[model samples]
Target: MIEEPGRVVAIEREAVWIEALDEAACPGCTASVGCGRWSFDWLETPRRRRRIRALSVMPLRVGDAVVVGIREDFLLRSTLAIYLLPLLGLFVCTIAIQQLGFGESLMIPAGFLGFVSVWAMVRRISRRQMNDPTLQPVVLRALPGASEGQVRQAAF
Candidate 1:
């Protein structure tokens, strides 16, 4: 299970809202800042809060810790809906436009533009969905020893 520590920002009867602690240092880095890439460290600074929603598995209070991520099936379904639906719409629209007896000059450009528009819309929707923290699933809960300060401490 891919798990990350987060603090409970809100607690409801059926759901819990947790905010993931941002890492101060780039977790992707392997170096000790000996390289010339220290200039990029500014980009690695953590944000203040990232709210996530989860089904309440345990009685959690405000300021508790939790982890969030989608199940594999849910992730797959989300990807297909976000990606394949637009492509299918593009394909169907193109075919319908071609069969409508419009001239190639008009039909081709319209079809191409339709496909592009669908692709652009998919991208926009995907970005918007990614911005919604509630879409993500809560997969695990952190132990009582987990410290938000430790998670936010910069390694560089």
Candidate 2:
């Protein structure tokens, strides 16, 4: 499971919108203690906000902070469904068409068609799985404090 803390932006019944910052996983290589990397990283990188809705186990309000989690397999499965099938479709269709002595013109169109067809098929299969429990992220618990004193007390 992968989890992150986010601030809840809105609530609608069981669903809450959470906005999480997408931080760069690495800031520097081994060489730099005080180098140009900090300024380079700053200008090249933009503020990234990733927002998603999660089913909450507890009642939530706007401005509340919470922990959200999703299974690792969800990421793997989604990537394969979106990318791998289309690439395989192009190879299979193009090769099969060429084996029949079709010209490049026919093979190219056929491969493009194969890519679109496979992409559509993957979309349909994934849509049918929209209600699958493993794919849905959920809010695990609320954060303890939103203000200064409560946060300081909890830190001790």
Candidate 3:
């Protein structure tokens, strides 16, 4: 499981809106200390904060600091399906159509259509996958002593 520190922005029953604290350090890079980019990572962060709706397994409230976690395998699987599959589909469709004596124009369009079709399928698949517990982010723990008025601490 991969975990990150977040602050609860809102609560509606069992669902909680969490804003993950942005980290300024390089994320698991080989040259974390030596790389110049790692030392200046703050320049890449967006000015706006990003939030997500995650499950509130335990009692939570607005302004509570929490640790949220998601399974690593779930993320890896989704990335492969969304990106690699459609690209493979594009190449396969183009090559097969060309070998079957289709014109270059037709082959190109067919390849694009194949890529689109695969992408559509991936979206639908992800919608269903959303309900899976393994993929869903869960509130792991609530940080004690952190009040609603306190500024969120960045977790590396």
- Which has the greatest TM-score? 3
Which candidate wins on lDDT? 3
- For each candidate, the alpha-carbon lDDT, in order, equals 0.65, 0.76, 0.78
Q: Per-residue lDDT for 9-92 in model 2, tens only? A: 888777899886554433234554455544565665465678988887687888887778888888788898799999999888
Q: Which residue runs does candidate 2 get wrong by more than 4 Å?
A: 25-45, 146-156
Tens-digit lDDT string for candidate 1 (1-156): 345667788876667887875543356677737645555545666455667777666777887655655666657767787778767767777777778877767766676777778778878877887646456566365545457665333212
Clashing pairs in 2: none
RMSD of each: 6.8, 5.3, 4.0
For residue 67, what is the lDDT in candidate 2? 74
State how far residue 130 of model 1 sits from its true place (Å): 15
**Candidate 2 displacement at residue 79 in angstroms:** 0.6
TM-score attained by model 3: 0.79
RMSD of 1: 6.8
Clashing pairs for model 3 are none
**Residue 62 deviation, candidate 3, in Å?**
0.9
Question: What would the per-residue lDDT of candidate 3 be over residues 56-129, giving only the tens digit for each residue?
Answer: 77888787888787888887887899899999989999999999999998999999988999999999988987
